[model samples]
Target: MIARLVARTFGLSIAVTVAALVVAYLYGGPAALFVCAILAILEISLSFDNAVMNATVLQRMNAFWQKMFLTVGVLIAVFGMRVLFPLVIVWAVAGLAPAAALDLALNPPAVETADQPSYQTIMVQAHPQIAALGGMFLLLIFLNYAFDEDRRVWGRFVEHWLARLGRVRHAAIIVALAVLLICAQIVDPAHRSSVLTSGVIGILLYLSIQGLTAMFDDDELPDTLDPAVPDPSSTRPAERDRPAHLPVGGKAAFMLFLYLEMLDASFSFDGVIGAFAITSDPILIALGLGFIGAMFVRSITVFLVRAGTLTEYRYLENGAHWAIGALAAVLLVSLKVEVNEVISGLVGVVFIVAAMISSIRANRADARAATQTAAGVSGP
Candidate 1:
């Protein structure tokens, strides 16, 4: 069973990694190959929480949409975001022509000067906008989760307060806007307007995606709570009994697909910037981060869903959101400060690990209680 699961989930990623490594060697020899390996590991480490977050939404989608996310979605992640998006950003930010931008990316200057900044220099220059946009979007995600009234407060003393705040209308929005304003204030005056604009765009984009999702989403609650006792008021047609997780095609699936892509992009933004720290070659960075890193991350998402890991490990999703909150804060702070990539990645791992330990203890306590109850009822 375990072997089959590994093969099913990781087979494609394994296959792709081998081929990419060969390409990496031919492109820049053993040093490049080593860098490529390091990058893949970094991406996977930093993105484990991203995979968990993806699985949460992916599980609600149908098989077709899930497959689409792995195949078509990853392609967009690689070529669109990984390859083309940075070029476009460089073009717009540097006021370079399209061809010039591509040329600069492909053949970046070996040394930096005022008139001739390398691709890495330019990408670093653009980090503030990238952070503002991606950070705002991810921050809102964490805020929403923190304020979810239905969430069980398992992790912290503050959660009781956060849950109460959920009762306040638009609490998440108010908090997000306040955070955005603070970030704007911290940023340099010349870039404050751009940062604010990027932050607002992120907010609008998230709202638009959520709006589209709700419009096309099936409103019926999942039957998992008590499948044997069906809710009569369910809107599902009597003749068309279907699994709640299936049939999420058409517009709803499309919206989900879009959201998943954006999530990947947001998570990738800082990683991409950090990759330049490893090596400034844009092509090399994309080869390592996009093809290898993204492929494994997608496989990990599939693995999590197939194993039912999220449902099995009760606090996993919550942990991922908390990690995301940490990431958002890091991203926003990174706009004006130099945050280490290792520190950012470690913050997520700590939250996830702590949540896992807490979940195990909770499970053990529940099992003991169940045993005691059963023993008493049977007069043991």
Candidate 2:
């Protein structure tokens, strides 16, 4: 029953994803379709572990949150992150109106038409600041994943005192808002409200959603699940038998979704920048990469469900964890200096592939031990 359910879920996600791509194709030209295909593959390759990371939490979500994740999540991925995000950055840095920035993106100078102002230009304009923000974001993610201790970005004084007062979430929200207000004041005091409100709301919206989701997910390696285990499947069944102890609930699931999107945005920094290097047409970049990448992520989510890859490949999680760590490092570097998407993509791929190979080898070894055990028992 569980297997069938998983299969059906996987199939449905894939169908929807493909349908979205078809719609994009109808609206845009063939070149748009081609770019979308490439973007989908690239995102899939970069995010092999993201599904695993999500499944760990998403499984605990109620049907409602899960559905919201697929639907709303897609909207955010396609529109906010892929299509509109670059424009937002461009406007913020270039002091252009949204429409003006859109114009710049849509129509580059005739000689520069072949290389119009694109997501890349936006990133370059905001490179100094993005590199700083992205670097910090990535660093925190990495430390949380790779280190042993529980990592918290907020200071201990604030966490203990403010949280004890039953106002930590509130205070944090306020602080975030204040920070944006200050930023807007510095950038353009008179016009600060418009950009400031949007920026704070955007970040807060995603962060709150993700935090809610993480409350439910409790999956992690037991201290004793040693690499020496001869049978990988043995661990999986055992892991499944154990009840989830993490904080995942409806509220938690919402938070997790928010976090995942933020994580996705962090990843998007380079991709958004890199897309422009290929072509400066924001429309082409948005239609090409957004639809394709979103579809691929949806497809991979389905594939993970169908293959039961999350359960079967323990090391895949390890790889993803590592990739997230690498990405965090990349983010940190981005804050200080420009880092190419190609390099970022390669770094993630290497970590995941290495972990996958190790996982397969371990599985084979486990199979051999089981075979020998059976022969020995029969001889007796």
Each prediction's number of clashing residue pairs: 0, 26
**Model 2 CA deviation exceeding 4 Å by range:** 1-41, 110-120, 149-243, 335-338
What C-alpha lDDT does candidate 1 achieve relative to the native structure? Answer: 0.84
- lDDT, residue 206, model 1: 91
What alpha-carbon RMSD in Å does predicted model 2 have with respect to the real structure? 9.5
Model 1 C-alpha lDDT per residue in residues 93-173, reported as the tens digit of each score: 888876888788778787879899877788888888999999999998899889886555655467768978989999999
Residues 121-232 of candidate 2 have per-residue lDDT tens digits of 5556565455435444444444334432221112224323433443343443454455444455554344345444445455545454545444444332233322332333
- The local lDDT score (0 to 100) that residue 347 gets in candidate 1 is 96
lDDT of each: 0.84, 0.59
Clashes of 1: 0
Report the number of the highest-lDDT candidate: 1
* C-alpha RMSD by candidate, in order: 4.9, 9.5
Work out how many backbone clashes candidate 2 has. Answer: 26
